[model samples]
Target: MSNLRVAIIGCGSIAQNRHLLEYEENKYVDIVAVCDIVEERAMVTAEAFGAKSYTDYEELFSKEEVDAVSVCLPNYLHAPVSIAALEAGAHVLCEKPMATSREEADQMIETAERNGKKLMIAHNQRFVASHEKARKLIAAGELGKIYSFRTTFGHGGPEGWSADGENSWFFKKDQAFIGAMGDLGVHKADLLRHVLGEEFVDVAGFIENNAKSEITVDDNAVCILRSESGIVGTLTASWAYNAGEDNSTVIYGEKGMLRLEDDPSYSLIAQYTSGETVKYELGQIQSNDEGGQTNTGVIDHFVEAIVEDKKPLIDGEEGKRSLEVILAALESGETRKITQLAK
Candidate 1:
C-alpha cells in the first residue's frame, strides 16, 4: 500500500517523541502536516519532518488529503480533535487518558464508528516486550488463580516531559482535568486491564497534589482497584519520587509471582512455586533519553490496521473501558467512597 498521509495535531513532547519520531521510522507513513497552537513549535516540527505546519488543526483538515491523523493535543482537546479527524475521513491515533470525560470519549468513539474510521489510543505500555510476555503467560494460565497485583508509574513530574515545562497545560485543571492519575496512573490501569484480561469493577483512589502544591491538579495518587473476579491491587502514580522514576508491576497468583520493569538488569522475573526463577531481559523501557529507537509498536500497529482493513488492538472501545476505570477512581477519591464501574 502507499504511505498513509498523516497529520499530527499538537506539537507537544508526546507528539515529538512518540508520534512524530515513530512516523519517521515507519516507511508506510508520510507526515503530511503538523499543527500546534504555538507557531514556532509547529514550524520547527514541520521543518524537521518535511511537512506543512499549521497553527489551526481545522485549516490542516480542510486543506490536507490526510489518510490518518494523530491527535496529540492537551487532554481537553483530545475528544473534539479526534472526532473532527474521523469526520474528515482520517483514522485517528490519539494520545491516552483518551479524554477529559466519558461523554467526550463516547462522542469520539461514535464519530469513528459512524465515519467507518479507526480510532486507537496510544497506550504504549501494552506494547512493552516484558509486558507482552507477561500478558501471554497469564493468558496461558501459567500463573493460575490470579490473586493480586500492584502496579505503579511514577517520576519527578510532567515539568520535565512536556514542551512547556512547568507552565505546560498539564498543570491546568481546565486543560488536564486530572493530573498524576490521568498521566501516569491511567497507563498502569490500562496495562493491568490488558494483562489480566479483566475489568476493574470498583476503585478507591486517594488523590493529592503534595509534590507540586502550586498546581491545581493532583501530583500523587494511590489507588485501590478490584477486578470483576474479586482480584485486588493497588496502583500508585506520583510526581514526588525524587530519587528516580519507578514504573513497575508485581503480580501474585497461585502458582507463581511475576515482576515487570522491577529490575534494572531484567525486564521480567517470574518466581514459581517450584522454586524456579525465570528472568526475561526484554531491554529498557522507552524514555526520552532512549532516543527514537525506543519503538513503542504503536505506529506500526495503527498503520497495519488501516492498511489491512482491520480494527486496531487498542481500539476506541477498549481505550474507553480503561479510561472508565481511571475516571471511576477519580470519582471515588472525590466522594471518599468506593466507586462502582459498569459491568
Candidate 2:
C-alpha cells in the first residue's frame, strides 16, 4: 500500500513531541508539508520531516495533495483548520477539546460527513497500554458495578509543556478557551467515558486562577461528575502542581477497587472483594515533570483507520460527547448550579 501523505498544521510542542515524531516513525506515512505561524518553527519542522514549509495553513492546504492532516493548532483554531482540511479532501486528526464550543465541534463534524472524509480527535490516553488493559477487565465484568472514581491530571503549568512556555497560546482565554479544564480535565473526561462505557449526565465544578498571574484563564479546577447509570466521581485539573505532575485514578466498585498510576512501581493495581490482589506492572505513566511521554499510538491508529476504510476509535461523535462533558463542567462552574446533559 502507498504511504499516506500527511501535513502537520502547527509546529508546536504537541506536533514536535507527539504528532511529528510518531508520523515519521510510522512506515505507512510520508510527511508532505508542515505549517506554523512562526516561520522558523515551520521551516525547522519541515526540514526534519523532509517536507515543504508554510506559515499559513490555507496555503499549505491549497498546495499539498495530502491524504491526511494533523491539526495541532490552538484550541480556537482546531475547528477551522480541521474543517478546512476536510473540505480540501483530506482526513483530519484534530487535537482534543475538539473545539472551543459545541457549535464549532458540530460544524467540524458536519463538514467531514459532507466531504466523506475522516475526522478523528487525538485523545491519546485511550490508547495507553494500561488503559487498554483496564478497559478489557471492566468489559469482562471484573470491576463489578463501578460505584465511584477520582481522577487527576495536574502539572507545573503549560510553561513547561508548550513550545513558548508561559507565553504560549494556552495561557490566553481567547486562544485556549479554557485552561486546565480543557487541557487536563477533558482528557480524564474522555478516558472515564471510554473506561466505564457510560455517558456523563451532570456535573458541578469549582474553578479559580490560583497560580500563573499572567494568564486570564483559570489554572485550577475541581469537579464532581455523575454518569448516566449513577456512577459518581470527582475530577481535578490543575497547573499548580509545582512539585511534580500527578496523573492517577482510583475506581471503587462493588467488587473492590482499582488504582491506576498511583504507585511508582506498577501502573495498575486491583483488589477484589474476595481478597485477591493483582498488580499489573504494565508500565509507568509518563512523567511530565521529567519531560517524558510515552507513545500514545494516535498516528498509527489514524493511518490504519483510513487505510482499512473503517472509522477511527475516537470518531467525531465520540469526541463531541467527551467535549460536551467539559463544556458542561465550565457552565456548571460559572452558573454555580448542577448542569444536566441532554440524552
Candidate 3:
C-alpha cells in the first residue's frame, strides 16, 4: 500500500512533541500538510517535515487530500475539526478530552461513522508499558477481585509545556473548557477504564481553581469513581504539583495490590498477601518535563488501525465514555451530588 498521507491540524506542543515526531517516524505515514492559526508556527513545522503549511484547517483539507489527520487543536475545536476531517474523507486521531460536551462527542462519532472513517482519541496513558502490564495482570486474576484504585496525573502546569507558554490556551476556560480535569483528569478516567475493563458508573468530585490566579478554570480536581463492577477509586488531576509531577496509580485487590508508575526505580510493583513482592522495571511514564520524550504508541496504533481497516482501541465511543466521566465529575462538583452515569 502507498504511504498514508497525514496532516496535523495544530502546531501546538502536543503536535510537535508527539503527533509530528511520531508520524515522521512511522514508515507508513507521510505528513502532507500542517495547519495552525499561527502562520509562522505552521510554516516552521511544515518546513521541518517537508509538508505544506496552512493557516486555516479548512484550506488545508480542501487542498491536501490527506488520508488521516491528527487533531491537536484546543478542547473547543476537537469535535468540529475532527468531524470536518472525517467528512473530508480522512481518519482522525483527536487529542483528549475528545470534546467539550457529550453532545459534541456524539456528533464527532456520528460523523466518523457516517463517513466510515476511524476516529481515535489520543489517551496515551493506556499505551504506557506499566499500564499495559497492570491491565494484563488484573485480567489474568493476578490481582484477584479488584477492590479499589487511585490514579493521579499532576504537574506544575501546562504553561511551560504549551507553545504560547504563559499565554497558552490551556489557561483559558473558553479554549480549554475544563482545566485540570480536561487536561489531566480525563487521562486517568480513560486509563482506569482501560485497565479495569469497566465503565465508570458513578462520580462525586471537588474541583477548585485556587492555585492559578486569573484563570476561570479549575487547577485541581478530585473525583471519586465507582466502576461498573462496584470497584471504587479516586482520580485526582492537578496543576499545582510545584515540586514535581506525580503520575501514578495504586490498585488494591483481594490477592494483594499493584503499584503503577509510583516507584522511581520500578514502574510496577506487585505485593501479594503471602508477602511475595515482585517488581517490573518497565520504562517511565511520559511527562511534561525535559527529556521526557517517549514513543506513546498512540500514533502507531492509529496508523495500524487505518492500514488494517480495524477500529482503534480508543475509538470515538470509548473516548466518549471517558469524557462522560469528566462531565459527570463537573456536574457532581457543581451540584454536590453523586452523578450516576448512563450505562
> Can you list the residue pairs that collide in candidate 2?
none
Best-to-worst ranking by lDDT: 3, 1, 2
Q: How much is the lDDT of residue 145 in candidate 3?
A: 100
Record all residue pairs in model 3 with backbone atoms less than 3 Å apart, i.e. clashing: none
Residue range with the least summed lDDT across 10 consecutive positions in model 3:
285-294
Off by over 4 Å in 2: 290-293
* Residue pairs whose backbone atoms clash in candidate 1: none
Q: Give the lowest summed-lDDT range of ten residues in model 1.
A: 284-293
Model 2, 1-343: lDDT tens per residue? Answer: 7899999999998898889988988988999999999999999888888999999999998888999999999999999999999999999999998998889989999999999999999998888777888888888889888899999999889898789987999999999999999999999999999998999999998988978888999899999999999999999999999888889989899898889888888899998999999999987765665554566788899999999999999999999998999899889989999999887
Q: At residue 135, give the lDDT of candidate 2.
A: 83
Q: Each prediction's Cα RMSD? A: 1.0, 1.0, 0.8
lDDT of each: 0.92, 0.91, 0.94
TM-score of 2: 0.98
In terms of TM-score, how similar is model 3 to the real structure? 0.99
Better of 2 and 3 by lDDT: 3
Q: Identify the leading candidate in terms of lDDT.
A: 3
